[model samples]
Target: MSSQSLEQRLLRAWYGKAAWLWLLRPLSALYCRVAARRRHAYLSGERDQWQPPVPLIVVGNITVGGTGKTPMVLWLIEFLRAQGYRVGVISRGYGAKPPHFPWMVSATDDPAVCGDEPSLLVRRCGVPLVIDPDRPAAARHLLASADVDLIISDDGLQHYALGRTVELVMLDHERGLGNARCLPEGPLREPAERLESVDLVVRNGAPGDSSNGFSMQLLPQTLINLATGERIAAVRWPGPRQVTAMAGIGNPQRFFRTLESLAFTFDTRIFPDHAHYDASILESLPGDRPVLMTEKDAVKCAGLAQVNWWYLSVEAHLSETFEAALLNLLSVPHSEKIEQE
Candidate 1:
């Protein structure tokens, strides 16, 4: 089976109770034991941790699948910039294979080499970002090169070797912990109790367990035509359009649902998270149909401009109360923030 199909199957097993849930329990027990031990090793000082010179914010999810971490990171970056804080971003580039350990990403960099998300961030925010498996090392590189006052580790909550100043855990409200088992048995990377320790819990979509934290949502802004560079409102576009909605990210169905919410009628094409696209994939889709996609997919499809392609752009907006609370948690002086900028 193709990797995409395999993951879909795995997600099914991980998401809900099934026969396989019982089958995987033994392995899950072992996995959870190892996970707990590994975390304790770092927490107890058996393993050395690296701390960034500046305050570090971690944008991560405890669940296996995505919980809108990218949008939250983008929103955080924009919010920090508006607050006059110089921010840098670091991430473990999954699909990237750079010759060196720490690779600096630029707007013109190829997504195939630097990973799709990093390329998208460069194109979207134009901030200084580094991709390395050792996230703390990446942050160090960014600090050495730029005058950034703080760093954001895109998604490294489980990576205990990297010490963090603030931790914000993002969760998909629709899938809240998914059977609450770790690894092969279910979707969680760590126990569900891990949520209690994070500084803030960011829930995407409808009402969830919001007793302690707040909710955030992605507002679709506009769709950009990759071919002509034209912009159209996602909801206000006038057309009984036959388009192909494509997404090659974690939770492909989320993109489809968002498009449906915007009243777009289109066939769905879901690819594995971070799947590399080639000419063959484009050929498989119907001809002459406008293709709608997430901005992350657009970065990979930048060269495959053979079809009429457009990608949705979304702005993540947080509650005003949450905004004030987050700023207070960071506790940086307003005058210092302005001076850093």
Candidate 2:
């Protein structure tokens, strides 16, 4: 089966609780055991971890798919900057193929080389960013090259080699834990119990149980034309109500739901997460009606986008309580945090 098909099937099996998934339970059990041991090794100091001199906060998720992490990281960047902190970001740059490891990414950097999400983050905020598979190497490089007092490791919660002062885990409130199983049997990379260990947990939507975690809403801000640098409020989209919606994200349905929330009627087109796009692929998109996509996909389609193509820009909005709690935690001395850990 094609990778897209396989991913769809797995997503369905995972969230739908398909009985066939039971067949993968043994493998999932083994995967969980190995992952637990690896984490234990890091905690026990069997593995060397690079501890940065400055504070480092990790914004990541336990699940394998998107949980609005990019938006959360972006929100943190702006929030921290507003609080007078110079922040730098590090990412694994999944699917990126830069000429060298530990490459510094700029807003002008090609999304195809440094990956879409990193490219989008740097472009959106112009924050200093470094991309490398080795989280420690990326963190060191970011510190050495940028005059940043704080570092945000984008999606590096599981990278135990990079010591962090804070961990913020994001979860899709609707999906929760998807059977609460690890890997092949479900969507989680780590076990569901891992949530208990994170410094804070933020649900991407209103939590079913208000006391469980802080709630976050991805509020649509505006829509930017890809062909030209024109911007319009998303609520005032001037195109036909029935447009083509294309999303190459871990949760395309989430994007579609956002469109629905905006009162738009759209035909859907889904791609594998981080899938690259070209003129040929887009040329086959069925209609000349406005093509709407997520900002993550827009980064890759800028040069190839048609005049009618636009991307919805959304911002993460967390409650004031969450913000005060986060700042309070950061106010705690790093030494105290380490000692507590």
Candidate 3:
């Protein structure tokens, strides 16, 4: 079966009342034991971890799907810069196949070569970014090449080989933890209790209650024409009521819901997370009324987009309390931070 098909089936099994998912619990248990051993190796110094001279922050999720990590990373980049710090970023570059390891990604780099999220990030903020499957190597390359005092790993919560100064975990407030199991049995990458060890837990949408973690909202900013680079306020979108919407992200439904909130009517084309696109694929859509997608998708489609193609841009907004708490945490020395951990 295709990855997309498997993903859909797992999503159904995880979030819905599918009794057969219990069969996979045995495998999940095995997976958890193995993961625990790997983590223990790092913690006990049985395996060496690369400790960077500068502080490194990891923004990631324990959930299997997207939990607004990209937006949170962008927010951190902007926030730290505003505080007069030179910031750099590193990512595992999922699905990226650059010619070499630790490749520096610029705004002009091809998304297909450096991965969609890294390309979108550099394009949006122009921050120094490096991509490699090896997270520590990427961090080292970023520091060697850029004048940065701090680094942010886009998504590497499970990469214990890379020492982190602070860790921020993101979650979809609505979905929460979906069955609260791991891997094929459910949607979590780690156990639910992993949240207790992280420096902060950020919920993507409005918190249902105080126990849900610090609230974060992905505020829509504007819509940009992929082909012409024209911008218009998202709330003031003056387009046809109906359009062809597509999202290849981890949770396409989230994108659809955002469009609905904007009063848009659309027929969606859901693709597997990180699915690549080309002109012929988009050309097959029934009509050309208008095509809208997330800015992350737009990065890959920009070169092949038609005149009517546009993508919505969003900015992450967090509460003042969260900000103050993050700043206070950053003020602590790395050694002391490790001791606390």
Q: Evaluate all candidate structures by whole-model CA lDDT and list the values in order.
A: 0.84, 0.89, 0.87
Pairs that clash in candidate 1: none
TM-scores vs. true structure, each candidate = 0.93, 0.97, 0.96
lDDT tens per residue, model 3, 98-204: 99998999888889899999999999899999999899999989989999999999999899999988889998888889999987788888888888889889999
Per model, how many backbone clashes are there? Answer: 0, 0, 0
For model 2 the local lDDT of residue 147 reads 95
TM-score of 3: 0.96
> Candidate 2's residue-wise lDDT over 1-341, tens digit each?
12365787688778888888889999999999999999999989998888898889999999877789999999999999999999999999999999999999988888989999999999999999999999999999998999999999999899999888889999888888888899988888998889888889999987432667899999999999999989999999777889888998988889999999999998888889999888766776755688899999999999887788889999989888998989988889878986887
Angstrom error at residue 8, model 1:
1.8
The superposed Cα distance between candidate 1 and the true structure at residue 167, in angstroms, equals 0.7
Distance from true position, residue 212, model 3, in Å? 3.2
Candidate 1 lDDT, tens digit per residue, 1-341? 12366777677667765665878889989988998899989978999988766788999988877689999999999999999899999999888987786999988888988998888887899989999998878988888888899889999999999987788999888877878888888888888888887888988884533685578788899988887888988877765577888888888888888888888788788888898899987678666677888999889988887537889999887888888878886897534643543
lDDT of 3: 0.87
Which residue runs of candidate 1 sit more than 4 Å off their true CA positions?
1-3, 332-341
